[model samples]
Target: MNDHITTPITPDLLRGALELERTEHGLAPHRLPVRARAQGDGQLAMAEAQPSGVRVVFRTRAGVVELDTLRTRVGYRGMPLRPDGVYDLLVDGELVAQASTTGGKVLLLDMATGTAETRPGPVGTVRFDGLADRVKDVEIWLPHTEITELVALRTDAPVEAVPAGERRVWLHHGSSISHGSNAASPSTTWAALAAARGGVDLVNLGFGGSAMLDPFTARAMRDTPADLISVKIGINLVNADVMRLRAFGPAVHGFLDTIRDGHPTTPLLVVSPILCPIHEDTPGPGAVDMEDGSMRFRATGDPAERAAGKLTLTVIRTELARIVAQRSVDDPNLTYLDGLDLYGDADHADLPLPDRLHPDAATHRRIAERFAEAVFSPEGAFAPQPVTA
Candidate 1:
């Protein structure tokens, strides 16, 4: 008989989630708080529930660990089924094992109709054994693309919460790219990788298809305690085509103002969208192109719409730069980073986006490396400030 001790899943053992909801089976970690979720639409609800950056973290001497979870995975009605969500186990901050559980629920989506169907399934377990019998920090990075509910956690030895170290808390909000769209695993996402390199605790708010500048989201960020903050804007706004240029500028300002209300001196970085060819000069209401059973996306709005205040990648970038410059007069901690510097036309030629929408796994790593160099290095904007008396 396998002897293991069952430990209740508690908030202290979780990282990167804004709130935890008590579910019938166990607990579901939500990236957005309850208030924000209530105001968000179905897209935001699904994105936040995906747990892009959430993890189960603790310290243990156990040689074997098992986690029972109920995961809700997304799928398209006609597109090829996505691969099972991956669970990455890290021992002492190094990826030690990667596992996945089967038989969880599936939410099949209809791309053209914007509707979805849920198929219920039973809970499954992910097990990782053969760890060296020594005390070490362990983190199980939940699948970034799945809605995972923690049912139970078991280990051969006792587990305890890891001490809060001196690492800075990085709270970032952005679009699906920041939400680990095509990243292989949770820990590999560009934001997650950048957080690891920066030696910071990541609180990711990169909701897929849901990075709209909502007031509630800003309030949540304002209330959340963090040493560093960043918001990647433009892409989602352009693709969704929800707001025009007339409304975009004020929305950006309002978003930053709200964040400053709570974190007046914290370093804030405003990043524009990366190089997206179709949406660079053209407006959007981006549409799906299911060509030959392969999924692709394209900007469908007319380019001339720019004359009427329609937003585009290029327009958004110029506005964001101007906004940051205007705000920096009094907010010295505010900074702007052009997304093209992270991924530009040159990059597209070398590492084209697989879906023409989201970056591939390798690109995610590349973005993370670039971001670390630009924001976390000694000379970077987010580098530690000097003390003065």
Candidate 2:
């Protein structure tokens, strides 16, 4: 006879064990958190999931709420949460959902009623349903004033996965115009529309009131991953009057250099500002009239200053082209696209920008179409290499 020994399991030993296991027989959904800028407000919708046979346990600063059955056919929208504190969700006590609203917006969900709301002030809560199993805890993350938390979460189930293969990634950075400023939907943003037209993934780094040649943003772009990249500059800088020509040249160089550090020979495109009559040749103390959509210009620099061929859009665009040409001599993959190429005098003449500034939705579509044609067409400006067997 052989003696058998049995090992005893203790709660402490299993306490650290990951108990949540997603299997074909059961379901566990992934949850995403929303983030909003300080004094900024917005909403976030959840990624559609297998609504049938799932339950959601949502947690917010307000408290925890359990949602009933979710509708599989229709995608669910999340409740609104403000940027008061960290927000999070847990399934079986394993942290699977998290988000922060430092200075931006955060959206949570309540699937039962199919209603979504934005959180007021700096903190809020939301809940969802269709969790296949039990949940243990929820969590939230609030880092700082500069972070905007917007996330898309889903429960694990039999959902169609994004096709895998050689995927095309579009990396873009620009000013508020590219940041979905007045666009009706996120997908309607010119950059987003362009990405869809080209069938490429997008990494949008468009920042409102913050595209003033920050080295940190350049560093961020340099470190990020992408198959194609473009930077929309000049408009914000000109409007802000943050730098003169003396500083602008070096800044452009530095910004591109930073991105080149990582992208190296990637298809990088630099874009100048669109046509703005007020700021085209005139120096700004730019003012916007919401009532009449007319812009009033205050002279920030002497007309003689610009008369010397400095601090004008023409000068900036020329300098940008020069720098890119010089750099492209060594890095053939780099390129530059004039903003006017997308929405020049003719296009603008027809679809004049509503406020004498930002393009309206129709103009956005035109710009998107032009960009797609230029960047994605077979003979487009930034076409991919022909694959060789």
Each model's lDDT = 0.93, 0.54
Backbone clashes in model 1, listed as residue pairs: none
lDDT of 1 by residue, 1-389 (tens): 08899999999999999999999999999988899999989999999999988999999999999999999989999777789999999998899899999888999998778899999999999999999999999999999999999999999999999876557899999999999999999999999999998888999999999889999999999999999999999888999999999999999999999999999999999999999998999999998888888879999999999999999999999999999999999999999999999999999999999889999999999999999999998888889656679
Each candidate structure's TM-score, on Cα atoms with residue i matched to residue i, is 0.98, 0.61
The candidate scoring highest on lDDT is 1
Number of clashing pairs per prediction, in order: 0, 45
Ten contiguous residues minimizing lDDT sum, candidate 2: 9-18
280-354 in candidate 2: lDDT tens per residue?
777654554424333333335455667554476666788888888898888888888888888888987798776
lDDT of 2: 0.54
Point out where model 1 deviates above 4 Å: 385-389
